[model samples]
Target: MITHIFNSSIVSGPEMLVIPALKKLGEAVSIIFLTETRLPTESARPIEYAMKFGYDVYSVPVNGRWDKTAFLELRNVLDKISPRIIHAHDVKASLYLQQAKRVRPGFKGAIVSTHHGASYRKGKIRLYEEIYVRFVLPSFDKVLCVCELDRKSVIHRGVPEGKVSIHLNGTDRPRVLPEDRNASAATIRKSWKEKMPELPDTDAAVFLGAVARLSPEKRHDRMLKVVASFKKREESGHCKKTVLLCFGEGPEEQKLRQLARTLQLEDRVFFMGYSNTISDEMAGFDALLCLSDGEGIPINLLEAGWAATPVISTRVGGIPDLINSNEAGFLVEKKASDESIAEQMWNMLQNTKQLTSVGQAYQKRVMEFFSHDAWLKKLNEVYATLPGKI
Candidate 1:
C-alpha cells in the first residue's frame, strides 16, 4: 500500500489535487497498489471525502503540532498497513514518518514530501516553516517541489540536490473553448453569478480577479490598490464598470477590506472568501491578478489557465516557467508597484478585444504541459524509485 498524509487542509490548492491524482494513479497502474489517506483527528469531513474516492481513510486523533502521542498512533497505522511509500504533505506528518522509520529499523518503506508553496509567513509560523525546511524536509526519501524556486530554495538551504524535483500541479482536462471567446465571456460571467450571489445581477465589461489566501505574501493590497489606480486613471468605459473580486480568506481579510475603503475602492473591490468551487469561478474573470511576494506554482493561476482566463501576475516561484512566453499570459516583475500593475490591468482592459484569444492561448499551454496524465506518470515514477531512492 502507498499512503498519503495531510493536515486538515481542505478545499484548498494542493489538497484539492489529491483525489484526482490518486484517481489517475489508479488508472495508470491498473490499480496494482492500494492507496490511503491519513489525516489528523477532527478531520472527519476530509476523511469522508477521500473515502468517497475509494482511498482507505484514517484519522489518527492528532491534537496539534505538540501532540507526541500521534506519532505512536500513526506508527500503529503504519504497522497495520505497511505502506511501501508514506508521503507526507506537512511538517508534522513528516516528523511522524521519521519517527515511525526510526523505531521500525526493519521497515523499508520510503518517506516522501511535497513542498507545495514557498509562502511568506511570520513569527511562530515562520519559525515552524524554517524548521520544516531546514530540518525535517531533508530527511525525506524524496522531496517534490511544485516549482523550481522551491527546489532551489531547499537545495541552497542544504537539502541534497538529488532528493529534490520540480513537479507542477496537474490541471483538470481542458474543455473546447468557444471560437468567439469575446461572445462567450458572458458565459463565464453567468457561471460566476450563479455560483456566487454576491456579484451583481448584471455582468461587467471587466472583471478583475484575485484568488489567494489573504496574506502579506499574496499582496492582495496590491490588487486593490491597482484597481483603484486603474479606475482613477481611466476616465470612463470599462473602468466605470470594472469590479475587482477577490477569492480566498485569511487573517488579512479585515485589513484588506479596510484598505480598500481607505483607498476609496470599497465599492469596486469585493472579497468572496474561500470557495470549494473555485475552478468554476475562474472563467467568469476577464483577467486574473497575482502579485504574491513568495509562491510555488499558485493553484489560482493553473485554474485560470485551465479556464482560459488571462492573467496579470508577478514572476515568482514557478510562475515564470508557466508563463514563460508573452503569448501565454502577461507577467510583471516581482517588485512591480501598484501603479505598474495597475497599468497592466488597464492595458488588458483596453485590449479587451484580444482577451479571448490570449486566454485561449494560455489555456493551450496548461493543457499541453500540466495535464493529469503527465502528473500521474511523474508520480508513479517517483513512487517506484523512492524506496531507498530519491
Candidate 2:
C-alpha cells in the first residue's frame, strides 16, 4: 500500500499530477490521501476521482496546530495501516511525518518527500526552509523533486545529491472533441466580450492570458505592466488591437485590478476570477502569457500546448525544460521590463504562421513527454524500489 499525505483537498497543480498517476496504478494498489482542510462542497473532486478508480479514501480531522497530538494521531493511523511506503507531498507534511517518526520510531516503511516548489524565494520562509532541510530532510529515506531544476535547488541547499530524485509532473491529455472545444471557445469568448464590449471581433483582437493564483510570486503585477505597455504601443499605432485575460483569484486580485486601473488598462484587461475549467478556457486565447517568479513545471502550460495554443513565458523554474524559444514557445527573461514583453508580443502577433507552426510542434512534444501513461510508468518504477514494498 502507498499512502500519500497533503495539507489540503483544494485543487492545485500537484494534486492534479499525483491523483491521476495514482488512479492509473490500478485497483490492487491501496492508496490513502490525508488532508487537513475539509472540502467545502463535500464533493471533493480529488477524493471522488480516486474512489472512481477503486482506491480507499480517508479524511482525518487535523487541527491547524502541528503539535504532539497531531503527530500522535498521524502515527497511530500509520501504525494501523502498516503502509509499505509513506510519501509526503509538500514541506509541511514532510516535517509533520518526520516529527511523528521521532515520537514513534518503529514504523518500518520508507519515507519519501516530493518538494513541489522553492519555498525559500518567499522572504522569511527561506529561513524556515533552510532549517527544515538541515534538520528534517535527512530523516527521509529519499527526497524527490518535481523537476531537474528543483533537484538542483534542493541539493544546493543541503540535501545530499545521492538521496534526491527527479520526477517531472504529468497530465492526462483529456479527450477534447472539436465540437466540445468550439463550444468551450464560444462560451469563453462570449463571457469576455460581454465584460469588455470594446473588444473587436477581428482576428486582430488577440487574447493574451494566464491562469494562476494571484500571488506575489506569480508576478501578475508585472504581467499587467506588460499589457499596459502593449496598450500604449497600440495607441501609438506601433501595435494592433489586443486584449489581456487573467483567470484565477487570490489575495492579490484587488491589488492587480488597482494596478490595471492605474495604468489605464481597465478597458483592455479582464479578470475572470477563479474558474475550475481553465483548460477549456485556454482555447479562446491566441497564446498563454505566464510571468511567474518561480514554478515546478506548471501543468497549465502543458495543457495549453496540448490544446495547440502557443505560450509566452518567463525563463524561470522548470519552464526552460519544457519550452525552447521560437521552437516550442517564446521565453522571456525573468522580471522582464514592459518594453521587452511588448516587443515579444508584437513579434508573435506579426508572425501568425510561425506561431501556429511552433504551437503544433509543442502539441507533439507534450504527447511524447507529458502524457498520463508516462507519469504512471515512472512512478511505478519508484514504487517498486521503495523499502518494504511487495
Candidate number achieving the greatest lDDT relative to the actual structure: 2
| lDDT of candidate 1 at residue 383, scale 0 to 100 | 78
Question: 172-193 in candidate 2: lDDT tens per residue?
Answer: 6564443465565566787767
In model 1, where is the ten-residue run with the lowest total lDDT? 28-37
| Model 1 lDDT on a 0 to 1 scale | 0.72
Model 1 TM-score relative to the real fold: 0.88
Candidate 2 runs further than 4 Å off: 27-54, 175-188, 191-204, 238-240, 387-390
Cα-based lDDT for every prediction = 0.72, 0.74
lDDT score, candidate 2:
0.74
* Candidate 1 residue lDDT tens string, 301-371: 88788778888888877888788888888888878667876777677767865777788888988888887
Flag clash pairs in model 2.
none
State the lDDT at 342 in candidate 2: 75
